[model samples]
Every structure is written in C-alpha cells, then in structure tokens.
Target: MSGSEPAPVEDRRDSWEGPVPIPSGANETFWEATLEGELLYQRCEECGTSQLYPRAVCTGCGTTDPPFETSEGVGTVYSYTVCHVPGEPGFSDRTPYAVAAVALEEGPRLLALLDCDPEAVEVGMPLEVTFWQVSEEAAIPVFVPR
Candidate 1:
C-alpha cells in the first residue's frame, strides 16, 4: 500500500488484557489521532527534527509544542527482538511475540509491537502500521509485513 493510505484498524478491545494507554499532556493528541487510524509525529518547524513519543518541547531546537505531522504509516524495521517470555502483564498468553523499532518514512522511529510470526521478522523488513484498539480513547500502533 502507498504511504498516503490510512493504516488498517483492528478491534482488540474485547480481547485486550494489555495495559491501556491513558491519554494526557502531549500524548493526548497522539492518542486521539490513533483512534482515527493515523500515526502522528512531532516535527520542529525551527530545526526540522522529527520525534515520536510526543513531548511539549522539541528535541531539536527547544521549540515549544512542535507541530504534528501524519506519518505515511509505512516503515522499515531498524531492529527487533522476539520475546519468549511475557515482558508485560497480560501478555503471558501472547508470548513469543515480536517487538521492533520501526523507522518510518516520515523520519521518526517508533518502538511498537510487530504483530507477526516471530520467526518471520528480520532487520530491514518493510512494514506498515496498523492499530489495535485497546480502549475507547486509544489504540496502540502495531506493525506488520508490507
């Protein structure tokens, strides 16, 4: 799929036993966008640095409240790990999952769950974002093979 297309959405709310994100502060906007199947990153207009895990101050130039830009939702796997053990609560049943640091086409990288068979993942693998709705207000981004 092309970068401009909306990422696919999966309704996991009924089965989600994972930790749910509570949107607040700078994260409020990011989480809100996710509910609509958009992945957003902050871009500093002053220094042109893009960042994820939204913060009030820009990492590049100390600019306050950097403007957000929607990502193309396509990325490359920069790095990854396979979890044989549950690292977080409620993930015991989902052990042997993959987590990856995905480098988006828009410049920022996101650490997200790679929702695919662990044995199938590799560095430099092309991926696309998808959301798993865990709550009414938030959905976590998950990446899958493109």
Candidate 2:
C-alpha cells in the first residue's frame, strides 16, 4: 500500500452525548415510574389494549389519545435471538447478548436485552424487567430470567 491516509469519518448515531429526547408525551409516566423502579406502558381505555414504546393513540383503535399505567414488568419471551453482532455502540462490550421481544402479561411486547444465560432463553421463558441507568434521565429496561 502507498503511504497515504484515509479521511476520518464520524458516527452520527453515537453523537448523542447529551440526554435523550424522552419522546414528548409517551414516556413521561414511564420515566416517572422508572424513578421508583417500576415499568409503565400505555393501556387503551377504549379497546383494552396495552402497548409499549408508548404512544398517543392505540394501535388497535384509532383513539385520539390513550392512558398510561404501570406494568407488572413480568413477561414471557415472545421471540428472541442471540446478537452476535453488536447493534449499537455501547453494546460492543456486551457482544453475543440475547435480545428478545417479551410479551408482558398486560399485553404489550417490549424489545430489550435478556440478561441471563443465552442458552437458558426460550420462546416461552418467563422474564422480568430490570433497568440500567444509562443517563440521569434515562434508565433502559433489560430483562432477566424469572
């Protein structure tokens, strides 16, 4: 190879050096509940559907707005995969971790990392929510075997 240098490129995704945007109206109650180590989700009063990544409207029904409620944080593995490739920057240290879509008892499915033995995870495995404080205002929810 010639004695040349490549230009430096910046990763914009990792540029989030500041606090994360708490997604306007959805996560207010969820974060509030997190302060007390509780997990929260949106429950549609109109259709009785519980959903996550909280939203202003129910996915099942076209309700103008929905209500927030605390979740039991207990769930079962709806689906999962062992991530051999790190999907995010901070997760490099946690390579080969298991990520799963857990269906909470209340009816919402949340995607989070499974903090247990990868070999122990199964489609119907019971799990519980746990939080890791990523920032002063954000605590990411992870799951462990129940």
Candidate 3:
C-alpha cells in the first residue's frame, strides 16, 4: 500500500540457475506485481495483519483469501547468513553471498537475497526491493541498500 512500483533494472548475473516461481492460485498476484516492478503482500481486512509469501487465508484472523497490498519496497535487516558454498546449481561461482531476513516497514518479514557484498551488511541496515525477472511469468525480489 505504501511502496511504489518502478521498472526494475535488469539483473546482470548470467550464472543464476535456481528456480523460477510459477504463479498459482494464492500467490499469483504477488508474482504478477513483480513483473510490473512492484512487490505484493497479503493484508487481512478483519484483523489487519500483513504477511509475505502470500497465503489463501489470514494467518491472524483465519479469513479466507485475503486481498493483496503493494509494499513500499523498503525494509531493515533483521538477520542474515553468508553462504560460501553453492546451495544449488549455477551458484558455485557466487560463493559468499548474503541471504537476509528483512523486516519491512509495513510489518511483514521476508527472506530474500541481499544484493551486496557479504561483509557490507549488518543487523538493522536499510534496504529496498528490486526484482530480477527470472522468467516471463516470474521475478524474484532481491534487496540492496536503500
């Protein structure tokens, strides 16, 4: 509801070969927004809880199929871990990347790749979301310093 959707800068890395998200029933809107340069989350109308990795019902209120809201795409680092080993194929050369738990300003926490030097991040660092279009139907949110 607060984050604006801006055209994403293309991700330069060509070695990435993880997985691409295929939009489905519950999370289709989230993936759709990514292509348009926006990030989406579900907010419950009844209990007012905001969450990521979209779900069919409110985790707080248990209401069915909560609506989606756009994120301001800004957050703070909550925690992180640096990976020196390739966790999946096509990532062997990308050793020492940081994966972080980012706490969004709007109230949800999400785990995303931190697009920065592993040594450059720390708890509470400010971040902003940018999408990397992994496929024509999907993009993944990667964060960098705001």
Candidate 4:
C-alpha cells in the first residue's frame, strides 16, 4: 500500500437491496420478529392508528409512545412497478422484478420485493409476506402471490 493508491471500496449489497431505513426507537421488536418469520407494527393505544417504519411517537396524535403488535403477514398490492433497471446490486440477476408497496390487512403499508411473475401482478392483488435472509441479524420481508 502507498499514499498514492486508493483504498478498495467495500461492497454492502449482500445486506440490503434498497434504501433500508429503519425508523429510530422502534425497530428492535420488528427485527426480532422477523428472525422468527413474523411481521410486526405499532398501533397507537391513544388513537387506533397503525403505522409502518415504526416510531416511538404516534404520527396521528403526537402521543408520547405507541403500542405494538404482531401482524398476520397478509396484505394486498397497493401499488407496484416492474423494474427494467437493477435498482440495487446483487439484483441484476433478478432483473425485471416487481417491487411493491403492499397494504397489510392490519393497516400499514410496507415496501418490499414482489416474488411472482411480473406479468401476473396488478394493483390490489392478494399477497403474503415472505422472508429473505440477508444477514445473521436481518431478514427482509418480500411479498408473493397468495
């Protein structure tokens, strides 16, 4: 190694495929549940509003804190897009895949990969949560036709 040489850039694509932002103060339970193949969300006890990207405070009423519960892992495609371009690394082999924002029956929308034939997907299509183990501590939730 020399001062004139640049350091090799590290690759982090194997960990996550997109902007994987986990909201502060509210992801421990959700990530823990994912390890067990379950999905979870927070529901405001003060006001019956459910939300994704879990938060410590309720987005509706600004409550000090909110309660959380496990979800059934069932949802419907609220919206989607067929990606001709590889949005993230490690996904070039899976080109032309569908990414969707699915609205869960319990009432929170989550963005995830849609695991089905691209031609078979449509808005409002039934879906169920599926897990993709990306690391020892994280497993992403993808969706598949139900």
Question: Which 10 consecutive positions of candidate 1 have the poorest summed lDDT?
Answer: 1-10
Clashing pairs in 3: 1-70, 3-71, 3-72
For candidate 3, what is the total of clashing residue pairs? Answer: 3
Q: Residues 1-146, candidate 3: write the lDDT tens digits.
A: 23354747465336448867889999888888888888888889999999898999999989999999888889999999999997877667778899999999889999999989999999999999888887877889999987
Off by over 4 Å in 1: 1-4
lDDT (Cα, 0-100) at 84 in candidate 4? 88
Query: Residue-wise lDDT of candidate 2 within 101-133, one digit each (tens)?
Result: 999888889888787888789999988777655
Compared with the true structure, all predictions reach lDDT values of 0.92, 0.71, 0.85, 0.75
Question: Residue 96 in candidate 3 has what lDDT?
Answer: 83
Which model is ahead, 1 or 3, in terms of lDDT? 1
**Taking the tens digit of each residue's C-alpha lDDT, what string does model 4 give over 1-146?**
11222212223447556544353356777766665677778899888989986777888898966887777788899999999899787678788999999999989998888879988999999998767655555567878888
Q: What is the lDDT of residue 138 in candidate 1?
A: 96
Candidate 3 deviant stretches above 4 angstroms:
1-15
Which residue pairs show backbone clashes in model 4? none
The full ranking of all candidates by lDDT, starting with the best, is 1, 3, 4, 2
The clash numbers for all candidates, in the given order, read 0, 0, 3, 0
**Of the candidates shown, which would achieve the greatest lDDT relative to the real structure?**
1
- All-Cα superposition RMSD per candidate: 1.1, 13.3, 2.0, 11.7
Candidate 2 RMSD computed on C-alpha atoms after optimal superposition onto the true structure: 13.3
Q: How accurate is candidate 4 locally (lDDT)?
A: 0.75
How well does candidate 2 match the true structure in TM-score terms?
A: 0.81
- Candidate 2: the clashing residue pairs are none
